[model samples]
Target: MMKQISLMITSVALTFAMNICAQQSPWDKADAIVQSLDPVTFPDKTYVITDFGAVGDGKTLCKEAFEKAITICSDNGGGKITVPAGTYYMNGPLVFKSNVNVHLEKGAILDFSTNESDYLPAVITRWEGTELFNYSPLIYAYHVQNIALTGEGTVNGNGSKKFSPWNNIQTVEQEMLRKMGRTNVPVYRRIFGEGYKLRPGFIEPFGCANVRIEGVTIMDSPFWVIHPIFCNNVIVRNVTVDSHNYNNDGCDPESCRNVLIEGCTFSTGDDAIAIKSGRDNDAWRIGQPTENVVIRNCSFRSKINGVCIGSEIAGGVRNIFIENITIPKSSNAIYFKSNLDRGAYIQDVYVRNVQADTVRTALIRFEPNYKGERSAFHPTLFDSFLIENVTCKQSNECGIYMAGFAERPLQNIVLKNVTIGKVPTPYCFQNGENIRFQSVKVNGKKLDEKPTPKELVKLRVL
Candidate 1:
């Protein structure tokens, strides 16, 4: 009887240990970490920003007040810097430091002045993947750690003003006239060359660690929104990112590591979530790939591709797992685009248990448009792509497409357990090696083909 009891206990212990060793997704850890931190103990409360002569400005540019507040918060062991209940306007970028919290009170608005001079040039930044010294982002953080932006308040870029004020036009086209250099603008534009050149955009946080942006609203970004470059251990949860204007993407996590983006809402004019490893020369300089990304329970609504990778995958991306996503509206539910300029391999990407409604194009696409997207700046490559257990309802077009360039094939991909509703056929595979499927069904029926890949490429592209 004693031996029997011991054996039972030993069996349970072994099972528990194995469960612990298994790879757990980011959502499992996100909620607990958020609850552990006490909001009252934020850095802004302890340091106090008044010493910097910063005041809550309603109309005028309160650059001094914000700088003082940020400086004080930085000096005093880093605390939450308060943007009091009012409109605080700034002409230039405000840099954030380590161990600090930038919390906006209810009804508070941090308005970034759109004057070109206000955003000083020569800031270390990346645009579309290329590295360059460009205009400052509304809220900038570089080389920081343990940072967070939490509140019910808003951060407005005032980008609309730039189009009307600088260029005297209505939208991105007029703003193009106001753009500093006509020649320079194309340097940052998408699908230009091998995707190596710098195209200026908004908000780049480089080499950061343990970052979080929660319960905040970011609107009217001047360019690609919320770009975290070469960061690690990042979390952006419970946030609302909305922009109806041009080129305002919700977030682009490029060359980052250990990232978790969950419980966030994204609605933008462009790709809601654009993943890239690096662009052009930076891809080679920063050879490290984006690793360990887990995006769960995040919903997106975008005019462009909902959740996309490449068009700027110069460095290579891997180990990306996007699950439990609900994209109600988009041109395409999930898109994987690559060309000759992007030489990096995209591998270990798992998109499962996702549902898309009212999709215009194929739900999941891997296309290397040979003559369509050739760039001199950013080099490109496509490899080891996978889509599984995805159900697209009321798709107006085809369901899945894996068509590649004649030179470089889209190889080692698998589509399993996919069900498409209200479509003729589920897939249209053009070129690739080791593409397989298992238990694949469309419109409640099994398919004639099987999807079997060579091996799972364990990599990271956040």
Candidate 2:
């Protein structure tokens, strides 16, 4: 009888262990997504741009030579187009094709012209969430698969000279574009390029798959640097961006999926990494969500947020994993902002192992009522955020600041193993539920409960 009892106990234990092994962690999907990504590769064949009448003297226009090399490379079953060490001037954009890799050698610089007319003959693109025919991005790929921009070199967008000044003059055109989007105008009719002051992105990949941008240094972008829209299986690794022009966001992945952004460094004028979907009606019509993104081992020093999720997230965002982030200085370490007009959901976000040296604003902030022109009455569902293993050395404002809508409060937020060293205000929770804190310390004091309204600090309207 004793032997039989021991056998039954062992069987039960084995079953329990199996069950535990079968249960998947929330992060298991991230691993699967990474594994499923197809690496962007090219054939061993090489097409040297210098062989195609390209001069690196920085005065001659190399557009024709580049076009010839890229065309020949793609026509002959695709290969690498090598740009040797020197400054090559491009008056127009370099549009990419499938299975082609543009590799720049060390000391090579592809200098883009600041002349607005060079980027005319508008391309189909989404600018700031609205679909329009706009100026071509400096480096653009559309509906291509298995394309790459690789090698140790620089792509300079001379925005400070001319393009940066357009920001102040673009307000009227920007408002008109938003109105067009709101009124459900046909995308074909929403064209604005020559007379409009809307700036173009530095590098944009639209509707692409298996895209890889690695080891390049980007600087002085007119608009967002490295904007990927409607892409899948994208990987941006080891790239350095140091552009401090107006609205020069380091990278904005919009309406993309299965993305991996790792080992990148950013010092930008705006958010270091801002994940977004489309704007409003345009996003709803497109019907694609930004999901399954993993951002790890990144360093940031930005004028705005370090890692952010939309003021333009109207489609939806989900299953984002951010870890091993180092922010030397930023307006906010982790920020989520969406106005009522956004009318979407952002859920299943996980962030861990973040270390911030200095933050001008809150360590983590959620502004459900982000400042924007609200045309509709649709509130976003912000839910299921798990932030842990965060350490902030100094924050000029609060440790945590959240202001959710009363109808749909921010739900299921868990902050664990977090410590903020020198925060003046601990927390400001306006409308939230199921917010649990474990092993969280603010200003050297363990937070046992939520602070009352009287203890809350007033925040300025950003």
Candidate 3:
């Protein structure tokens, strides 16, 4: 039995290696990044939607059909449940069991019907990592292993039909509700339980293992798209995620591990690529960090952040790498936000070979105000952040802003081979220590700290 188990493990490892390259060391740059993931077999099987009596009725709510199909697939050895080419108007969240793959074929759409009855509650899920007992997600994969949602189809979280897709409006509402001294959740009290209480984002795989989402379009989620919280060995590539409405973050890797997001296009309202752990007490409870994540070969447009971290990091995070990216036309290019209330430690993040154009807040932003969101009164630490080979043009404020509490400072944050539209002064560089600048430039004029003039000339020529 032991030998058989060893052989099975070896075979799976070999297959994974053959599909991509051998797994790179945590500190080493990958030799090559694969654009797609080859299917790996576990106990999960492939299930057809036609078997569950779905007739592709746009008006008809196919909740029962989808539930039946997922049930059937679960009863079997846990396989893939396919939605063929047509419109499947599913009403609430369709819960996926472990080892189930929800595939939507070409020209297929999993439309979310905007009805309260469709969203039954009392299950465990989150919005920005806050434990919630409200409406469920459009499609949820929780605590699963070796799972996926692939193929050329669309998962439409019909949020526009419900919530107000403007951040200013929602932010105002949240503040007004907070002033009113309401006891319920801020999202509920904000709208007085009337509006779509902020349509929760679609496509959340929570606490899953070995997940993949590729070759699909995730559009118009009321919230963040492709949120995988506390998952491991995940890959999201070759997907065009376009949610232009408010709070419509493209992809949020919150408290996940060993993730690779590459070859994707993101046009969103909020952060195009976000890293989170959890929010406040909920995050403190989970205490899981999103680590070993790589975001490469991607493009972004019309979002708040090209790449961002925090605003919810009750748990610590480390070992993040974002490389070979393009950010065109965004409010802010790269951002990092945190507060003392989070009680999380962040370290060892590297961003290299990034190119951005026509952006607002380019280069880097690490601020206590965090773009005027909330207060910065906690004790938080940020260290060992390296940004290199980055070129950004056009932004509003200072190129790089690192301001934090006096005690918990931002240290050892090296900016190497970087250039932005303009340069700005520091609020206080006392705590933001060990900030080395090598071969740096501002709007293409090379700065003085060029370690080697020959090497700097070569770099500038390129």
Candidate 4:
């Protein structure tokens, strides 16, 4: 009998070890998708802007020059349009074509004029999650593939004193747009420009594939610095952004798939990296989810969350992986937010190997009461979150704050090998289910509870 019992214990231990080995961290599983991304390529031909009558003296209106250059490049089956080192003042929008690369040399600056009228002939865009025809993004692309904006240069919006002030009177217009989204107005009919005060994103690539924006320094964005909507296979690498205007999220990827945001630095006014799908009814109508996104090797300094997942994610967001991040300061380190009005789901989110100096609010937050209406069209669900190997030096509020509705309790969460140096409250959970903490230390003490050994065996084996 003793021998039988010993054999049984040995078998169980071996099985447990094998199970641990077989279960891979979410980051590892994300590698297949990340590695599958292909770098954009361009033809050998070069179209120098100066060769097309573009002057570098900063006072020259280079709209026609840029238009002519891009057109010539596109007509010749696509190649690189080089902008040499000087201030190239752009009076209007620059639209890119497929297989084209706009390469700027080290001292090149593409300064956009702040005159609102220059952005006339509105284009289809989303403002605060609502789909409409708004003013054209400074650098806009639609339905193009293998397009790039590369080289070590700067794209300046020049929006500080002019564009940021539109928020003061945007209250009524904002409400009207939200109403339009809720009422399911035809997207083409929701036009706002000329007299409309809605701001446009600085660089928006809509419905594009194989897009790359690399080694560029962007500043003073009118709105979201880099907004990629309805795109696939996107890469924003080695980019530096410093935009502090209103609604100046560093990078906002909406309704995109197969995205990789790596080796970037951001100091912005809003969330450093906000992954969004769409808003409310419009999202439901569009019916496209945002998935297969990987954000890695980035440093963030922002007034809002370092990595945010919603408030506009009504079409659902899934299969997101964040790793090797450093956030010096922010309101929240990782925030997953949605309200009653935005009835989307957030799932399969993994955050790992992060370091933060100070988070003004919680290190991690999940709130179901974001700014929107409550509707039964979709039930808001937040689940399947894994956070490991994260360390934060300080937090003004609780270390972790998660609240779920009583009907749909947040479920299947695991936090392992985490540490927070200081926080007023280490943990705050309300209406959560199946939350597990293993080796999670807050304020120099391990969390006060853990699952029983029998229950531990049943937790998700991650």
Q: List, residue by residue over 266-311, the lDDT tens digit for candidate 2.
A: 9999999999998988898887889999999999999999999997
Task: Quickly count the clashes in candidate 3.
Answer: 8
User: Would you give me the overall lDDT of model 2?
Assistant: 0.90
User: What lDDT score belongs to each candidate, Candidate 1 first?
Assistant: 0.69, 0.90, 0.70, 0.88
Query: Where does candidate 3 clash, by residue pair?
Result: 44-78, 45-78, 45-79, 45-80, 46-80, 47-80, 340-378, 360-395
Angstrom error of the Cα, residue 60, model 3: value is 2.8
Q: TM-score of every model?
A: 0.79, 0.94, 0.81, 0.92
**TM-score for candidate 3:** 0.81
Q: Please report, as a residue range, the 10-residue window in candidate 1 with the lowest summed lDDT.
A: 453-462
Report lDDT (Cα) of residue 42, candidate 1: 52
The residue pairs found clashing in candidate 2 are none
Using TM-score, give the best candidate's number: 2
Model 1, 280-344: lDDT tens digits are 45566568777667778989998877888766676778878788999988877888876655577
Candidate with better lDDT, 2 vs 4: 2
Q: Count the backbone clashes (under 3 Å) in each candidate.
A: 37, 0, 8, 1
Which residue runs of candidate 4 sit more than 4 Å off their true CA positions? 1-21, 372-378, 449-462
Q: Which portions of model 3 show Cα errors greater than 4 Å?
A: 1-45, 165-198, 371-376, 421-430, 448-462
Best by lDDT: 2
Question: Could you tell me the TM-score of candidate 2?
Answer: 0.94
Ten contiguous residues minimizing lDDT sum, candidate 3 = 453-462
